[model samples]
Target chain A: MNIPPAYVLTLSGILFALGVIGVLIRRNAIVIFMSIELMLNSANLALIAFARTFAPAQEALRGHVFVFFVIAVAASEVAVGLALIVAIFRSKESIDVDEVSSLRG
Target chain B: MDWQDFLSVLPFIIVAGWATILLLVDLWIPANRKGITAGLAVLGLIAAIAAVISRFGIEREAFDGMIIVDGFSSFLQLLFLGVGLIAIAQAYDYLRRRDIERGEYYILLLYSLSGMLLMASAGDLIVVFLAVELLSIPLYVLAAFAIPQADSEESALKYFLLGAFASGFLVYGIALVYGSTGTTALSGMVAAIASAETTPVLLFIGSGMILVGLGFKVAAVPFHMWTPDVYQGAPTSVTSFMSVGAKAGGFAALLRIFISALPGAAVMWMPLTMWIAALTMAWGNIAAISQTNIKRMLAYSSIAHAGYIFMALPAAATPEVAPEAVRAALFYLVTYAITNLGAWGVVLAMEKAEGSGLTIEDYSGLGKKRPALALAMALFMLSLTGVPPTVGFMGKFYLFRAVIDANLIWLALVGVVTSLISAYYYLRVIVVMYMRDGEPEVRSEALLNSTIILTAFGTFFFGILPGLLIKMINQVGLLDLLR
Candidate 1:
């Protein structure tokens, strides 16, 4: 069954909304990072979905390639991000985003 | 890439190669002489500037249009490289005083600059995404370079999380634009947009998302929540570079993509750009007046400047005015860079180790303690306040003229009012410096002293005599902006 591109885009949009909500609602730094990853994955989903319906098979093929690059960049970001979390945890003795409040006015 | 295309991007290639080579060379250098790494980086940057100058008027694309070499990008190339050099000079003493003078600091800065150069030249959506990440990640590291400091680490954490979230929006926007137009390259997108009859829903949504992402990068009002915290938390040197370098990269992407690829859809994005510019100016200027911490105050001022620069964005909707608007924006960025860096140089000189002496109160009696530094600080404040006989005034003149020419009279008026409001806080720094009397404990650093004086003189030089820069701006404007 061929799913309409609009339906796929809608699903991606919903997932993106969930990720945004998670970012706003979650207090844990780790969870927030996970939410960011989720947002990126949702974008990846949209990219591939749109690629599927793109005319000219080769143009669609580029979309699939784009998803791979996105995943790779996301991985690098997570690696650095988790290391930063560890650094923050060591210094502050907590991973709670609320506790990381030394910078505010 | 063809040899000719490679020649177009030679300056970029040189800087990227310089950074990579420095990474290996940094290992062999004895730890105590980390200054050598900075020297090498500066030399490389100068060489790259020479390369950019040599390639003037040569325009071409490489890697099948993933990157384009053009006059506009060359102008920004020189700006980023110049900013990077001054930042290194400013950071030299501060890092040593704080015990964080790793050779890697210079290396990371060079790489960050290389990324910004690419952002100015990127011709495709994929290149934009890559360039943004490449530019951003090094900054994340540099912001937290003083890892022992909890505040530095926290700044890095906040910046990373928010930055990642923004990247998601940027990529999604790219995907949707691709979905609507069936192309990823901006040039191709432009062609597709011209062929299409009306602006599509998917493309409009895509452009809005893209604006959100760039907004966060440029620190426009709503997306600017991370700015003050990050600016205050990060080491002053890192904040210095990040403020000017990263913002330039973001604005470069915005100016090029919107003006080049999406001017046809101005009816969709121009109004949104207008509101963003207006709200950003009002919020940034209003919020800046209350900050006691100098870094946080500068952070707000930078946001206000972003709004002023963005005024040129809406003006870009008119093809007749886009070139002038962009030229004005470019001129403003250059002036702001010098004045802001000069102010930060004074701050860096005055700051005691472990982030002491950062409050505005710390400037009391600075005029008595370090008269030269105090005088430099006053000059920078005057420039920031847009006082006459300074580059800031000329920059604002050009910006307001373009906005008025485009019939954005209200926005231009908002800019004037905000500048008036901004004068109070900027002048307050001077008032405290000259009028108040308390012993200000300041560090003595020669490189930073020179930077402060150089930038101060530059602000004056460019202000009274803008003809030199105006001629260069006319030459370096986007080649096809009128097309």
Candidate 2:
């Protein structure tokens, strides 16, 4: 039994939307970071699905290579993101995004 | 990769390798004398600038078409290198005064600069994505370089979260684009689009997503919420560098990807970009009027300028105006970078150790206290307002000409009106500096003064004799391959 490419893409798209919404509503820095991770994972999933769909073409392999690149970028983002959060947390004693506002118009 | 491939990316290699080596070298240097690291970073940038100059007038694809060494890339690389040099100069004294001077500052700047260099040369979507991340990660860290400070760390967190979120959108867009086009190479995507039975919906949606991602970087209107906060909260040196480097990098990719690869879909995207440009200009300039903090005001002003640069995109949709539009955009970017940096340099000079001297009121009596510094600041303001006898005016002239040539009369009108609105605020700074009476304290360091003088001279000299710059920009062939 084979799954349709549309199904995979649809699932990925839904996950991405959820991630975006999570980022919008969430106040906790760590949870927002998790949402971002979900967004990146959904992108990776979509890339794999596309790579498989276009497997017959020579350029399709780039999609697979791109997935690895995205994974690496996501990992680096995690390192940097966590460090920034920790630094902010230390200063404010809270990880709530709204409370971090010392700057405004 | 062949020797030729390596040669093509020599500038990027020199900076990246030099920075990595410097990271190891910095361990031996003591904390108080981090000036050595700054000097080494300047030398590395000078070497990279020499490399970029050598590659000028030569265009070729390298790394299996993932990168293209062209006039476009060479020009932007030189600008990035120049920005790096000035950033170091600005940071050295300011960091020392604030007690934030460290060897890592220069290393991180060099790394971020290498990413910008790669961005200018990227020929593939994959490389574009990688370059964006490479350029941004260092910036995220650098925004918080003044560690233990609440404002700096908060700014970094905001910048990182938004930056990562933006990249997620960018990558997902690339995946969708790849799914429909079956290629990630820019040239390959073009060919695929030309041969397809119907233009794919996924391609349009994907490009839209890509626009959203880059819009955040360039600080366009809808995506500009983070600009003021980050610019205000980050250290002055980082804010100045980020304002120029990151915006240009975003535009570099935006122009290359959209104009080079997605021209087939211009009919759909053109109006969208035009509207965004207009909205960005109006919002930025109008919002700038009420800002009390100088940094936040400039943040809004930079957003307005992004809108101006963005006008070139829609104008380029007209095939006849395409190359001219590109030249105009590049010219405007050069002007903006020079003027903005000088303005920030003046700000840096006036800034206090504890960051209290940043409000617009603090600039009062600057003319009475420091005439030369005040004069440079006034010149920067005039240039930014697109006043005559300054590079900013010439830049706006050429940009507006391109817009009018492409028959974007309404868009051009929007630009003119917003520029008018922008003058009200920009000129207010000049007013506060010259007319008001108060003693303003400023640090007079040799390096920072020279940077201010150099950029101020460029702003004025280029405005008077723009023909020299225009002649050089005309030589750059933005769409030579397609032609």
Top candidate (TM-score): 2
Query: Candidate 2's residue-wise lDDT over B342-427, tens digit each?
Result: 99999999899998899999999999899999999999999999999999999999999999999999999999999999989999
Top-DockQ structure, candidate number: 2
Task: Estimate the TM-score of every prediction.
Answer: 0.98, 0.99
Query: What is the two-chain DockQ of model 1?
Result: 0.74
Point out the worst 10-residue segment of candidate 1 chain B by lDDT: B474-483
Q: Model 1 over residues B302-419: C-alpha lDDT tens digits?
A: 9999999999999989878888999999999999899999988888987888688999999999888888888888888888878888999999999999999999899999999999
lDDT of 2 at B483: 42
Candidate 1 is graded, for docking, as medium
Q: Where's the lowest-lDDT run of ten residues in candidate 2 chain B? A: B474-483
lDDT score at residue B410, model 2, on the 0-100 scale: 97
With a 3 Å backbone cut-off (N, CA, C), the pairs that clash in candidate 2 are none
lDDT of 2 by residue, A1-105 (tens): 999988999999999999999999999999999999999999999999988888787777898899999999899999888988887777789999999887888
Every candidate's DockQ is: 0.74, 0.88
